[model samples]
Every structure is written in C-alpha cells, then in structure tokens.
Target: MSAPTATARRSRTRWFALGAVAVAGAAFVAISVSGIGDNLVYYWGPKELRAAGDKAVGATIRLGGQVAPGSIKPGDGVSNLEFDVTDGTALVHVVATGVPPQLFRDRIGVVVEGTMTRGGTFEGHRLLVSHDNKYRAPADKNVDIKTLMRSTAGLEER
Candidate 1:
C-alpha cells in the first residue's frame, strides 16, 4: 500500500490519543474502586455489632441477621416497628419506621441500616430482606392465599 497521507496520519494520531485517555480513565476508576472497600462497610452480623459496644453508638451501620423469634413488636406510634436481629450467637434490638418487605417474618434473613442509640438499641430507618435471585412458581396446592396476602399487605418503601 502507498504511504498514508498527512491528513490520514493526523486522524490516526487523534484516535491514538483518545484511546490512551480512555485507558487512563479506566485504570483510574479501577484503582479507585479497589480501594473503596477499605473505607466502606457492607454489613455486620449481630455479634459483630454488639462487640462494637460504645463505638457503635450514633454510627451508621448495616446490621444483618435473622429476625429473632418472638421479638417482633409494634411500637407506640403508628407504623413504628420493633424487632431483634440475631445470628444465633448474639442479638441487637432494632426500632424502625416504614413497612417491611413481604419476605419479612420470624427467622427470616434481613439487613437493617441506621445508627445505634446510646441505649444500646439500633434505630433503623431502612429494612431489607435477603432473597435469592431465582424465581419459582409456587405449586397450586402449596400456596396459602390468606397467608400470602397478609404477608404482602404493605410493600416496603423508603
């Protein structure tokens, strides 16, 4: 092939510069994301939360565990809820507002986020139920209409 024209060379050079910038930007993003884990926490179990003790007060935390059996209670205000999260080793009492998801029930896996009060209670503002990604249709005979409707009475929001 014949040598590239001057215009062609300039166009190629511009493309190379753009590629280099894109690569640099990608590398920078990768490095920044890699270091983020050290500064942020995803979740902590009840035992770990309790262990934090005095340090936990007023700290934004995501506490994860199963809902303790017999601990769900309605608070004084309407829509206020109280419950306990347990890892079978320790438990943290949680006071939250807003509706819980349909899957929320006794012994169900959950993640609650908020700050710990000075009284050793977690004041949760958000609640999440841990669920598998896969979806399956329930058998006609296995599903209970009454129970299902009760469980899904209020959809979780906020």
Candidate 2:
C-alpha cells in the first residue's frame, strides 16, 4: 500500500480522535449512572426502619429521631456510646464509635448514620444533633431593672 497522502492521514487522525471522544463519553455516562439508585443512602425514622424489618439489615442509612430519654450510656470503650433513637412510634438502639457532641441530650433530635446489624441494632459511625435556628432569651421576671442596669453599667465603654 502506498504511503498515506496528507489528506488521507488527516482523515484517519480525525476518525481516531472521534472514536476516542466517543469512548470517553461512554465511560463517563456509564460511571455517572452506575448503580446510583442502589447505592443511595436511605433516610428512615425508627418506625419506618423497623417496619422495613429484614430489608433494613446491612443497608447504609441515616436514622433520624429523638434521643430516647434516659437511654444514653457509655459503652466498652471510652469513645464508644450507646443510645436508643426513637421516632415516638419505634426505637432503634445505636452503638456508635465517636465522642458525641456536647449538645447531645435527652429528647434532643439526632440523626445517626450507619447500617443495621442482624441483631436488630444500628451500628452507627456518625452522629449529628439538630438545633434551633433562633435563640430566645430566658424568661425571668424576678430581676430588678434598676439593679440589673447598675450591674451592667460598669460594662459600658467609657
């Protein structure tokens, strides 16, 4: 076969470039769409999670609920904490490995992320606390306005 002419060489180069672009685009689409539906993290409250029963096991999920009052307790390790999360209709015991936030308290809203074990307990790796967006002043009527003003008078810039 004779050496390819400049025009023929350019045509082959153009076709190769198009083929490379097509392969890259296909790879990108396949990666972006692969099993994302199956890999999605489930968000479930205690009730819904418990209702799901066997299907809940081994599934990565975010469980949101109130920290059941009087349920917070230390576990085997100093960093390990155990508590029951309740949605008022059901409860899921969570054994987590991490220092819970200082704001963690009874009846406070919390969300734990992890998977449910076959033993029906949630093995959490992360915890988050929900907090109010606005702050409200304490309601105290016993403070004398004159005394309060006098106490704060020294704090004002001279």
In terms of TM-score, the best-performing candidate is: 1
- Candidate 2 regions exceeding 4 Å error are 1-42, 140-158
Question: Best lDDT goes to which candidate?
Answer: 1
- Cα displacement (Å) at residue 77, model 2: 4.3
Which digits, one per residue and each the tens of the lDDT, describe model 1 over residues 76-153? 764679999887778899998888898788866688999999898899999998753333468666655434332111
- The number of clashing residue pairs in each candidate reads 0, 0
lDDT value for candidate 2? 0.76
Report every candidate's CA lDDT.
Answer: 0.77, 0.76
